[model samples]
Target: MNLKLIKGMRIVAATHNPGKVPEIAALLGEDYEILTAGQLNLPEPDETETTFTGNAMLKARHAAEQSGEVALADDSGMSVAVLDGAPGIFSARWAGPGKDFAVAMKKVEDRLEEIGATDRAAWFTSALAVAWPGGPCVVVEGVVHGRLTFPPRGDRGFGYDPIFIPEGGALTFGEMEPAAKEAISHRTRAFAKLRAALID
Candidate 1:
């Protein structure tokens, strides 16, 4: 689905993660100019929120206030049901302090096994927030259901993608092609909703 924003409307994507920048740019379409918080040297506030929406808003607000432009931010993570929804907001830092997704995935697997959870039903959640300076802010969410697999597979994607297999798929997200994965990823679902809201 293609959507167009007003020309000359610069939007800041409030993320320092290189992984997210291009995806946001692609989702926002060509009419809107996309900028990164790192490029603008925008300060990142501590994400003390307990929910993805709150964290997304916090980052988007920071970017909007700093750049004096509308900002879009997304917070996403994997939630394992057997683990009691652990590693939710802390998905990025689950591996102690750094953004070590491999370690985080191992920890998740260990925790699940510790509980003897054979029916590992889980879901990936993504929340996209857009803040327009002092103007209104909007938050949209989307989820993709899946189950966990032993011994992470493939070398594509980041985070728990290597271990999580989406429903009706043979390969884990890490094993799927980028275009194939993007078609049904949690972030893509959320961004699709956000695009509809913003453009229509």
Candidate 2:
């Protein structure tokens, strides 16, 4: 079966994170109907996986099973080199749940300082998985390399956007507009790859 997304396809996304919905919708375009876990009233699955790919696949599989439709899932976060790739999958819980991104950001900054990381080298990674109930599954990934900033900037995106200054750009991801951010975001990169893999 062809894996490419066809127009008017009902795509179930395994996430309640509202911030991600718009981006995903934009990529999938108007031809696809995007449904989130919140809309389905599905219980949030525990991210017990150690890697982003594993977590993404887990969510996608679970959602596809529940909805009996093609489901997409993304697991993404910041990976600090100095931190030994820590806050990788735990980036969300770093704030102690409740989805408090602000707390998480502060914690990241504090940890960076504690480690005396002057370079602040870090990368935001996004792993995407798509699964169809009783069908094969696919996975792809993307990353944007950049350095962390002490004080946050702008207010366009969510999570680690404020501090993530993409390489070669002065402004942080949070400083850029939604459309602009998506153009170079890790998710976009991964989706582009996935699209090519399917369509080409």
- Candidate 1, which segments miss by more than 4 Å at Cα? 1-5
Best by TM-score: 1
Alpha-carbon RMSD to native, per candidate: 2.8, 1.7
Cα TM-score per model: 0.93, 0.92
Model 1 reaches what TM-score against the true structure?
0.93
lDDT of each: 0.86, 0.86
Q: Give per-residue CA lDDT, model 1, range 1-200, as digits (tens).
A: 22334667788889877666667778766777788898888888899899999999988888888889888888999888878888888888886677777899999988987887888788999999988877678899999999999799999988889999999998999999999999999988998898788775
Q: Which lDDT tens digits does candidate 2 get at residues 1-200? A: 87777778888999987766777887766667898987898788888889999999999999999889999999999998898987899888886758887888899888878877786889989999999898878999999999888688888888878988999989899999877788888988998987777534
lDDT value, residue 150 of candidate 1: 78
In model 1, what lDDT does residue 74 have? Answer: 86
